[model samples]
Target chain A: MRLPSCGCCAIAVRCRFWESRIDMPLIEVDNLSKTFRVPEREGGFLAAIRSVFNRRFRQVHAVRGVSFCVEPGEIVGFLGPNGAGKTTTLKMLSGLLHPTSGTATVLGDVPWRRHSEYLRRISMLMGQRSQLQWDLPALDSFMVHAAVYNIPKDQYRQRLDKLVEMLELGPVLKKQIRTLSLGERMKCEICVSLLHGPEVLFLDEPTIGVDITMQARIRDFIGDYNRRYGATIILTSHYMADVTALCKRVIVIDQGRILFDGQLEALSEKLAPFKVIAIDLDADTDGYDFAALGDVLAKEDRKVKLRVPKGAAASVTGRLLRELPVLDLTIEDPPIEDVIGRAFGGSSGVGPEEETSAAESQGGDR
Target chain B: MTAVARSFFAFLRKGIAVMLQYRGEIVLWAIWGLVNPAVSYALWSAAAESNADGTIAGFGRGEFAAYFFAMMIVGHLTQAWDTYEIGHLVRSGEMSPKLLRPILPIWEALAGNLSYKITTLAFVVPMWCLFAWLVRPTFDTSAWQLGLGLIAIVLGAVLNFVLNYVFALVAFWTPKLDAMGELYFGACMLWGGRFAPLDALPDILRWLSGLQPFKWMFAFPSELIMGRITDPSEAFRGLGIQLAWIAVSIVGFRALWSVAVKRYTAVSG
Candidate 1:
């Protein structure tokens, strides 16, 4: 094998060395495990009273032997369904919860140790909870967080103005958090989280319960923040729109394990080998067997969609192009949600047939 | 020095701003504080009037008012309920955002507690004055007694905060902290010296009560103010007891905090 030149080799070695030292890995996780000891409760007043004396605990492994590293300035979307340990992983990284075993490091510090240096440099925003004190204006909440974060006056002002301008908070910053609409409050939450200019931003469903327009705006701002500060962002969201808009790479985890980790396109290429084929036939055709080409994903009024295995797609298209009086035809990769669902063996929503088709489609990637 | 003072004043101003907004809740809880003392006052006054000696249990009607009245304000300032609250947050996966902030949750809680006192004292001060005017209690205050009273209150507040924090740390070990709350409240209410002076209880009970950290929190402070411990030597001894409890609490807090965090289930974020 041809090797790199000495100058290039030196740079490569230096990069490897830095990666090894991990003085400041934007994100680092090593064999991390979190098992929740759930109290076993049986229905009835007797059991409740008995629990007072004979407490029984059963372990639920929420996260098991998970390990990964994220470099600075990288936007990695952690994808999983409910009970898939996605939120658990995010909590561990943000130091909201400690791991039962192994280690995790952010900015060269152990996360659960609650070191101030690490905390000052990172911010965690969850879509379901209000970090800002409610019953107060966005501006008031921002002031409180600014104090708690110990943000310098000048930096706080500059960052606040920048966020307010970007998020269009001029009209709503004065409104009480309770008064603001869901979309509006989400923006304000993001603003407060970023007020201190954190180097690492952990967003757990940051756009959940947001409208399409607000979601798009928040996604755009996240991209902007990353571009401006080179901040390392680890975001967890169930919505495909979030990952599609902002992340190039995604980590698919389920049942406390990482299922897939790579580029977004690579995910589809590796898991979904079938390209969806759309047909608009002039003549009505019911009971048509497109499964000969691959598997049928859906159909609507003279229009049909079939996911054909990658190699067969072109050949099948040629046959349908020749045989049917097709009004229009199109080819595209399956939806990311479908591909991800298929990757985790229909855990999200994809069915067995679709998973097989997606699996075959990914085989075509090779 | 000016810069330090200015920045401190800035924190103070911000603290005041936050305090005023929660002033409503603070006033409501202060009303709750008034309840127990008010009940005790009525009960003791009735007993004093019915007594042939016209003095029930070494405390006359006015003396009972002074004792319970002082208690109302002191207990309010020194109370903490975060042990169960924090546990609930951790168990329900709601505490992640708090851990993410640069400030410790304890620091924020402490600041909020201190700020609440500063604002709510408005009503507390006024109510005390009105009560004192209505049934004036003759106070015997020398320079030493006044000094001791102030010191006792301050120490009591610190000791209360530290002990409450120690109990809160238990949330890391046990998720069901409501039971812990019940146990702590029961112990502190009786042994903590809030109901009556530990000294007034029978010898065995009083001695056992003395071993408890609660009496130093409220009993000694009320006694110092009431001039019950007028003997200079005894007053010094009371101060010593309060100081010793404070030391035990601080030391216990340091040890408990680390162990509790270690045992913390480290809930899935």
Candidate 2:
């Protein structure tokens, strides 16, 4: 069987196609980078005192030459390990930080220039931070934003009602932000941010500490908002479920470099090509050789789990059913967490590609 | 209202709402502001009594009472606390969200300052009036001089605010601005004529105070209201100096702000 084209290569082709049709992308980033100069201090008191007069400094390259463009109405996942320059890139694009070199344009305006016209059309939310006044009800803070954005009284009221109803935020609107649950506060945060109806949204780990149910709800809201407004969105998250659920296309980075950028399914095919099959036998397995079917990855009680190449998974399952007393069985792709772990060169367990095909040869199954 | 004015009023309203939560703090600050003037009045009154003659440093007992009372009002009207605020915002990285807004973050500070002054004055002005009645202080300025002095006081407040804000921008590079704030206040006390009338200081110190912008912030306004500089030409000169300082401060604030913002965003990035 032939493997599909790599997602990263396909992105280049898609970008070229987009360029042919449009003069400039909605968000265009070209070799944008950021570097920092961190001071170094010696441990000893004498050395520290001496260093004060003549400081030692080291250059830290937080973001290297990273280039990518986001088209209008695209919900793209920005996936990367910690310290991989995800937040730095977001800051540069949002005008919070200027890039050390290179340039980026958001909605045809340079982000670092922080043009009021450009700012009024974009919004950003960070998960761990709260922009709402803590001691005041979320409504009051909403009013502040309404004023900041200069929303006409009637328009502001209309938008507030719509957002409140859509988010089911009536119960929590009157409560002070500090008293609200994390999820409730996050909802309010999202609501207040959208009162301006910005064209572009940058969300950085917006569900970091939210519970599973809340995370799902937030993801749904994000999807609904994108569809309703045709708003372009760029989200960075550690949860694979979020990326897989909301993002059809994802950009993966490691060490400030773009490792992969294209369709989400294509990424799985490129990085991890095998699937897992778990079998639960009705009878004891002492008399049969399970390893002949595939490489056994794990075994416990009467259940056996096996790893096999994607192409061979069906044939191997058919043979197992014919030759073994199989009570139940299921085939699934490798978990994305493990795949990304391996992509970052994590050596804690089996490497994604090196995990050879296997049937669960009996160990504890008997 | 124009767009900018609308935004300013909106922020002003929000600031008032937030400040209402800290009413206790306002009361405490008002008390502290009054105490400084009380101390100055007491010291000057004692000096006037001891002088056998009816005057000390050109201040009669009634004149000293009037000077201290005016000084108290001017000081409260011109107070700035932006150094502590900007330092906290820079230190804790809370300035991030503020910067993302279309408006400059400084506008929020300005609005907040205005709200605080307006709210506190409601309570403070009545108390000051009662105190002035008890002290029986005299006001000798003509109607025109009094009107010009009010303008001077407003300019003085703006000058002090811009001066402190410019200094506070140093927090972009270093979070430890408390020392700098204290240093600035100390200079004001020594040279801005908080402790005594500029006439009471050594000739050299008084000359230096006149040359620097410090005296114009507090002493010039208070003295103008008290009619201490009776010469019309001298009073006009004082107003001119205050205007010059205000111009200098605005330019300095913009320059420092540009550099500080660049340093902050670059380093934090």
Question: What is each candidate's DockQ, to 2 decimals?
Answer: 0.37, 0.47
- The local lDDT score (0 to 100) that residue A67 gets in candidate 1 is 64
Worst 10 residues of 2 chain A by lDDT: A357-366
Pairs of residues clashing in candidate 2? A294-A358, A294-A359, A295-A358, A295-A359, A296-A359, A296-A360, A307-A358
- Cα lDDT tens digits for candidate 1, A38-157: 889799999999999999999888887666667779899988777778888887887767788877767768888878778888888888887766666778777767676667789989
Summarize candidate 1's per-residue lDDT along B1-269 as a digit string, tens digits. Answer: 34333334444555577667677777887887777667767777777779897775687777777777667656776666666576786677556566666555666656656766777788888887786777676566678887888788888878877787778777777776888777776676677666664544678888888778888777777777866678888878878888887798879978886566556544453
- lDDT of every predicted structure (CA atoms): 0.75, 0.81
TM-score of candidate 2 on Cα atoms, chains taken together: 0.84
- Worst 10-residue stretch by lDDT in candidate 1 chain A? A2-11
> In model 1, which runs have C-alpha deviations exceeding 4 angstroms?
A1-25, A40-57, A273-337, A347-366, B1-19, B22-24, B265-269
In model 1, pairs of residues that clash are A272-A361, A272-A362, A273-A361, A273-A362, A274-A361, B192-B214
The DockQ value obtained for model 1 is: 0.37
> Per-residue CA lDDT of candidate 2, range A1-366, in tens?
111122212232333464554234677776778888888987999998999799999977777666676778989998877766788888888888878998787887898888888889999898766788887889988888888888889999998998998888999998878899999999998998899999999998888888999999999989999999999999999887788889988877655556666778877676667778999998887867777767788888899988787899999999989988899999976665556665545534533233211101110010
Best by DockQ: 2
